[model samples]
Target: MNLFELNQAYRELEERDDLDLETLKDTLDAIEGAREVKLDSLASWIEKNKMQIDWVTEKVKDLQAKKASLTNLNKSLQGYMTQSLDDAGIKELQTKNHILKPRNYKASVVVDSLDDLPEEFKQTKTEVTADKKELYKVLKDGQEVPGVHLKPNRGTVIK
Candidate 1:
């Protein structure tokens, strides 16, 4: 209600000579008590909502950090795996098994035996054929066959 309406209502109540003073005081007290109850209820509602808001906020932050860590871990693993494939000569295995004869060898040995390999078998190419006549000749001449050189994990250097 507008201020004028409220003022009029108060004036009317005050001018009511029929109502006893005790009854008027009791009614005013009841209105004040109701206002207090409403305020208290509103405070409780805010408190409850705050608990949920705090919990959700914490969970969101934790998830964000975990996501970042997972992403970094994935990238690190990808890089490590690529290095492993390169070191292990995975490409040579695939090409040799699919297109070349079964001369079981590692990448380093295959690279060193480049002279013995046929033009096609030196690496992997479309026009490649392996003629191991030279490789066998060298071995037959008592020269050690060129193979993958594997040293002990920890040992004296042997040149």
Candidate 2:
């Protein structure tokens, strides 16, 4: 039976007290068996999907490495072309589909030493966070903490 049917049967069996003990036990066993099968099927899917995820992750890493290599090559070729154009004193070159020219960009700020930077040019950031481990210890010892409370963690493991 499907999950819904199995659950319905379990609920119905739970609410009934008229059946003989043997029949009740058998019915509950049947429901439990169905649920077990469903769990097994679900776990199997999880295992298969996990394998696929690992494979895709590896593929993505490989592709990323290739892309990085290509990007570096592109940068190297562009740098070489730009340097060659500069050596030749070529201000601009026009092709059928494109025009290549050097243009000036705004100067970028480079920080040599943060400590030596002027105070007015520097900014400070502060962060505050709760100490969860310490809080857990206190809460677990039956002490109350403001703004937060302990919660029971429910989790499942499959093998």
Candidate 3:
């Protein structure tokens, strides 16, 4: 029987005063054993999924590293081609299937040091955040915080 049905049967057995001692004990033991088996099965399923997640996480990291390397290589190749074209004094080259030309990009400001930046050129940002650690300490000591309260949570740990 499933865990829920087994639990119901066990409860029903408790309310019955007509069963003999031996029969009552045996029935409860059987229900308990069934529940144990169901729990073990569920825990095994959780463990299997966790293993798959770890494997996929590692694969994703490897793929990201490979992509970054390929992107850097592409930038290097483009820079080399641009340099070659400029050295050859060619404004544009027309091939059988493609036309390659150097184009000017819009000018961008480069910052070498933040310390040297003028006050007018710098931007200030302000952020507000909750201090959960301090909140926890205050709440545990029977203090009150407006619009905030400690919440109780439960989690299962499998080992």
Candidate 4:
């Protein structure tokens, strides 16, 4: 039976609080039979569509790899084109289908190490963070630090 029909049946069952043992058993048996039919239909549908699912999964992986390859190629070509334009003293090149020009971007600062910077040239930004791995190690060694505590977490494994 469909969900609506099953729900109506359940509602009828719920209203009859004085149902005899035989009547309750029959109702339960009907519900279980309907559930088994639904499960069988679902399993059959999945089996029929398994091949299409596998094909789509493979195509997605292939497209992702191709996208990564194209991205790398674009970066390489952009660098080479930029160098060629700079060397040839051409600022911009326009064609019917495309326009090639150099776009200026903000320069980025590269630092070797934060510790090597002199105090005067460096700005200090303090951020407090908990090192969970180190904390776990300390707790495992039977030691506790102030302001830190371990808590148990529970989860269900569905398999």
Q: List the residue pairs that clash in candidate 2.
A: none
User: Which portions of model 2 show Cα errors greater than 4 Å?
Assistant: 1-33, 115-123
Candidate 2 structure quality by residue, lDDT tens digits, 51-149? 989999999999999999999999899889888889999999998998999666798899999999999999999999999999999999999878989
The candidate 3 region of ten consecutive residues with least summed lDDT is 32-41
Q: List candidate 3 segments past 4 Å from native.
A: 1-33
Going through the candidates in the order shown, the clash numbers are 1, 0, 0, 0
Off-target runs (Cα >4 Å) in candidate 4 are 1-39, 108-159
Clash total of candidate 3:
0
Q: Give one digit per residue, the lDDT tens place, for model 4 in 69-142.
A: 99999999999999988898888999799899987789978999989988898887899999999999998798
What lDDT tens digits, residue by residue, belong to model 3 across residues 43-127? 6656777998999999999999999999999999999988989999989999899898977789889999999999899999999
Sort all candidates by lDDT, best to worst: 3, 2, 4, 1
Off by over 4 Å in 1: 1-33, 92-159
Instruction: Estimate the lDDT of model 2.
Output: 0.79
Residue 83 CA displacement from its true place in model 3, Å: 1.4
For model 1, residues 1-159, the per-residue Cα lDDT tens digits are: 454654454455545667787986664454323454534433554465678799999999999999999999998986676666677766533453453222334655335666776786555548676456876666667677657232336733222
Candidate 3 CA-lDDT value: 0.81
